[model samples]
Target: MATRKVKRLYRSDVRQARRLLRGHTRKTPVFHTDILGPRGPVPVTLKLEYLQHGGTFKVRGCLNALLQTRGDKTGVVLASAGNAGIAAALASALRGMSCTVVVPESASHTKVAAMWSHGAEVLWHGTTYAEAHKYARQLAAERGAMPLHAYDLPEIVTGAGVVGLEIEEQVRGRPPVLVAVGGGGLVAGVAVALGLRGRVIGVEPEGAPTLHAALAAGHPVDVDVSSVASDALGANRIGDIAMEVAQRYGVRSLLVSDDAIVMAREYLWREFRIVVEPAGATAVAAIQSGAYVPAPGERPVIVLCGANTDLATL
Candidate 1:
């Protein structure tokens, strides 16, 4: 496996990245809310990233990586559960680079179709994202293609930090917590951007507690992969870089039930008119299930990460 020392992104890195993404991605809204307030006395702000380009915040990092690798039209290859593939394909299309995406057999058809629509060659591999990633690496090496890791690169993390940067500016003051966790990229980036400014509580599906398992083992360790949010949050193990950044920033991880994710999805659609995949709603699950209580009068922020879901399921 490839290994590299990953640095925590500074405020200047995020500031420079924003300039790079000016016309490409939106500064998604951070809406202060009381909608889920009946359950607790704390106010909440939802960072609506589902509204971002390519239907998720993945575009920020995808575009950043592509831009950094500019002048290489030989194209890039990547593996993703869904959203990352869509983001990479869209970025490739915009840059006129040939792109291929390896996705797990378990990925939603809607996401697969979106990749095709963006002119990306989609290859289905094993039953999970990790398997697809393994194959993608082999294919990239064989084709002399650049590999764009979904969560393990510094550029990707720096790009994702933009979400926290936008939220910090939009929210005015620090929220008590910002909830999100996956293969650890999103939370890691957000934590770095929000470090010492506020607390960031990471929420993962109990079925796919990559970060939790990593923390317990004192390093990135592979965990069982079974979760409704598996397509998006599922990684056999947390990325080594993400783990380092997250641990250094004091990020705490929490687990939520699959039932909570379903309810969170429904809540977002019914109340806020937002459609999100299970992973995207994980942060909301933390709030809905009372997994993390807010301090009185303190604000809580949930990063609504993505919305690439099959409409029929909604």
Candidate 2:
């Protein structure tokens, strides 16, 4: 007899993760606004995840992974673009665990510095995240460290899904969520949590359109990754978990140009005094550029995912 496998992230799992992460992570607040939609001024909500610990939502997943580690677990190794590495390193530091983070040469100095500040041994590997990831996997196997993927693993995704649970609790009626997509873990987790209650719209930079390519091909596939937001939003391919959830839940994908992303970042600062990185502002870019138009009388919600950036750049 075939046994039915449990889902990687059930509602109960997400709830438990939220409880476990309560003190470790912040319950980021949502801000409401009226944006000019296709029809007229439409109500909108912004999830200020940039204010989250480690300056990004990645901390939730990292802390969850750290908390779930067994006594026998010795060390952690992972490849990251930036935020995930910083979050993982921070979590490892809090747990007194040894951690190593490998990142592409293209990773931001500000983010790498943050990771180091948290006491993680950091290595600069290849030119792109994909290249760094390959090396990290090999190193982890050789060192016997627990391999951590930024967005692919079930536990990581389940941890990230806690964001969705918080959103539903903060805003009743399950408003459509606009999420910035990199490797797609955040959106996938959100989709799993929200299910039929809300719609998940994934926004990617046009320059690094991994999920866009995957959606067009009807499966995850390699794509050339480059963008102003690439350091934060770059992934060579969409994860299998993300693709499965997207397909099952009908998650829609959208793209915004680098120009739009820059404008959105500036707009956020100018209008709301929010300093967000290019990747963090990608979801807002979709709305500001009309790449994503809200339905009449529909109040959409955008997840402002990260704020890890060189303030000098801002």
Candidate 3:
């Protein structure tokens, strides 16, 4: 069988997106802390992507894809579990384009409202992300609108790779990066940016291990999804581009329980006054639960990627 030609997102691609998004996106700084460095005196750096425009790292990819592909009067369509929908809506609004977002019934109400607030025509579809994705594609086809993928598209992942570039330049010691995986876009992009220089740990909720299952199967495979983080980290299957990047770069996948996720979220609030959604707390959950322990002297960097949560619940 002939091997499929996978278009890789190189470091140059990431740099290009970073340059393009300079004036539009926020350059979130690293917050150094000793809270998770409990194993010893090692420092822990948190890349506060939750402070980004549209309140998540999803904005980076959404904006980049729209910026690169949008034409005058171009309409866009996308399916998201939650955060990606809001990002797409915000990106479209910024670019002065019309957007329609199809979201799963399981999506958070706050996220759906945010998408609507950004001038997107929001539609409720199936109960899972995969189902919504199928309907979204059909809607795009019917309406002759440009279809935007939540994670699989090269432009999106390439934009996400910019986060890794920022992390490398912003952090003092170029520490290992720990990121939560949903459809695996963020980790794959980070893998491309960091390459072999630093370890990229891909964290996931125990209830929804899409990347983990894919890595175990040696390919992208559908998995059952259910967890506190499902609204954000609930892709039925890992994206092909993401799997290729992860395997090529030797990105490590780790899983943490939902309880650990709650604990991590609470810890962030207690220590840093940071309010993060469940998916945003997955990386910290791995450390807090010892799922991915830092070495004696290794400095681990965690990317808190979203804040579009119902703060009242927290």
Local distance difference test, per candidate? 0.82, 0.86, 0.88
Global lDDT of model 3: 0.88
Q: Candidate 3 lDDT, tens digit per residue, 2-97?
A: 024579778888889988888988988889876663354446789999999889898999899988884554889999988999999999999888
**Which wins on TM-score, candidate 2 or candidate 3?**
3
Better of 1 and 3 by lDDT: 3
In order, what is each prediction's RMSD in angstroms? Answer: 2.0, 2.9, 1.8
Best by TM-score: 3
- Backbone clashes (count) for model 1: 0
Candidate 2 lDDT over 223-292, as tens digits, reads 8987999888889888888887887788999999999999889888887889999999999888888888
TM-scores of the models, in the order given: 0.95, 0.95, 0.96
Worst 10 residues of 3 by lDDT: 34-43
lDDT minimum window of 10 residues, candidate 2: 1-10
**Total backbone collisions for each predicted model:** 0, 0, 0
- The alpha-carbon deviation from the true structure for residue 91 of candidate 3, after best TM-score superposition, in angstroms, is 0.6
For model 3, the stretches where C-alpha displacement exceeds 4 angstroms are 1-4, 36-42, 70-73
Q: What are the per-residue Cα lDDT tens digits for candidate 1 across 62-173?
A: 8988887855457889999888899999999987788899998888888899999999999999997888999999999999888999988877877888888888788867
